[model samples]
Target: METPNRQGRRRIVVGITGASGAIYGIRLLRLLRGLDVESHLVMSRSAHLTLNCETELRPADIHALADVVHANGDIGAAIASGSFHADGMIIAPCSIKTLSEIASGVTSSLMSRAADVMLKERRRLVLMVRETPLHAGHLRSMATVTDIGAIVYPPVPAFYARPASLEDMVDYSLGRVLDLFGLEASLAGRWSGVAAKRNPGDAAHVA
Candidate 1:
């Protein structure tokens, strides 16, 4: 796939909700910046708390990474409108509450509202769901969103990439998510299964 074309710049709406993997959202912004993608960021109130709890970076730092920052309560933001020509939207570390809101189309905040716009416009929407041990209700919500063309992607690490650190794992997962939008990031290394298989000393060859 090729990068989206919009006035010679790829525009992506990024959302960060109250999920455990706050770093995913942060790394995603950094990667987008490196790729020269125009990013519109929106973060939930709970996301701020989660960011505070998980990382040392402040809200100012996050806001600086994006081309534009929309307040969570600002449902009137451009991204909340379907007419906005955005390539796609990605919610990294998508909280279950946020996911439920998006699935139900009861978006109370800009984050979910923007996500709803993506669906209504038939644009790509990727949710890096961060919950575990989900109940049936959570599963149902994921299925509903999937049926509506949203990709409910859990940030499952790719062991095939042989990630050496937490940063590597996070970048690889975000890179794969960006792949859904055709946005390439240098952080993720492509999987060379054939090359690994050809190496006699490789772990896969041993098995």
Candidate 2:
């Protein structure tokens, strides 16, 4: 797929819910900043608690990375309406509570409202649900969202990158997610399967 023109930077709404992996949301912001994408952020109350529990960075520090930060309780934010155009929205480390809200079309907070707007506007919506040992409810919720064209991406690691640090792994995961929206990123390693496909005489070998 062709990437959108960069004349104006793409706008992506990012929501950090109460999930345990606040690092995913933080690293996603950093990666989006590096790509020059416009980020609109919303953090739930539970997300604040998780942030305090997981990382040393303050809320202000996290807000600094986004172009605009809206309160999670603010359903009046531009991102919460379909009239506000955005390239897409991502709910990094989406909590089960938030996921259930979205799946059920309950838009109580800015995060859930923005996701609903994304879907209704026919824009891309990616949810990195951070739950394990899924129950039937969780599976059904996922299926419901998937039926509505939202991507349910689990934060799976890529061993092929041979990530040497936490940042490296985060970058790989974020890059892969961004790629789904046709965004180009150099943070993730590329596959070079041509070498494996070649016969000995087919090409000059590299050591």
Candidate 3:
């Protein structure tokens, strides 16, 4: 059975790596704050560099969104243990290096350690791998993690949602991942029946 935190709130460990899409992690944290979930965040050193390059927010600004912030090097953190009693973990914009470390069961940082704990405890673990032009090595790593019960989620945008902005796209993806943990968020746009759009020279075909 799943356990909530001491305050009767679900706990989720969020990890951000050095991937190009840092906004995914940042927006996820914000979404958690509006829900009844406590977020424990740990970001790799490279994540800070990427965040700086991608946005104007400082590290402190990003850290403030989380309920608890852990150092990546702190392997002995609470979330690193199976007894920490977290609902699950989500590595937003997970980097290839982080994915490889988790897949190999050779966790070097607290983020990966926490992920390992989630797997051992039979808890939900989502890795939003952000990479393109993946080679065979990357595919193999993803398969290995999947075999061990970790969900390999790539944050691919869904144009079917008709997102008006980039934030809409990111929120929808993360919200769907949150659904795996049974935490519902309003950020994700629900898909209904397909709506067709026609142009001046186009004809609609009904089946």
Highest TM-score scorer: 3
lDDT for each residue of candidate 2 in 1-207, tens digit (9 for 90 to 100): 222434577888899998989999998888888888888999999998999999998899999999899998887888878778688989999998888988999778889989988888888999999999999999999999999979999888898778899888877888889999878788876987644476777666555
Tell me the tens digit of each residue's lDDT in model 1 across 95-120. Answer: 99999999999988899899998898
Better of 1 and 2 by lDDT: 1
Report how far off residue 101 is in candidate 1 (Å): 0.7
lDDT of 2 at 14: 93
Query: Which 10 residues in a row give candidate 3 its minimum summed lDDT?
Result: 198-207
After superposition, which runs of candidate 2 have C-alpha atoms over 4 Å from their true positions? Answer: 1-7, 194-207
Clashing pairs in 1: none
Q: lDDT scores for all predictions? A: 0.88, 0.87, 0.92
lDDT of 1 at 17: 93
Q: Candidate 3 lDDT, tens digit per residue, 1-207?
A: 357878898889999999999999999999999986899999999999999999999999999999999999998888888888988999998999999999999999998999999999999999999999999999999999999989999999888787899988898898899889877897755767767777855654443
Q: Least accurate stretch of 10 residues (summed lDDT) in model 1?
A: 192-201
Model 2: how far residue 14 lies from native, Å: 0.6
TM-score for each candidate, following the candidate numbering: 0.90, 0.88, 0.92
Alpha-carbon runs more than 4 Å astray in model 3: 195-207
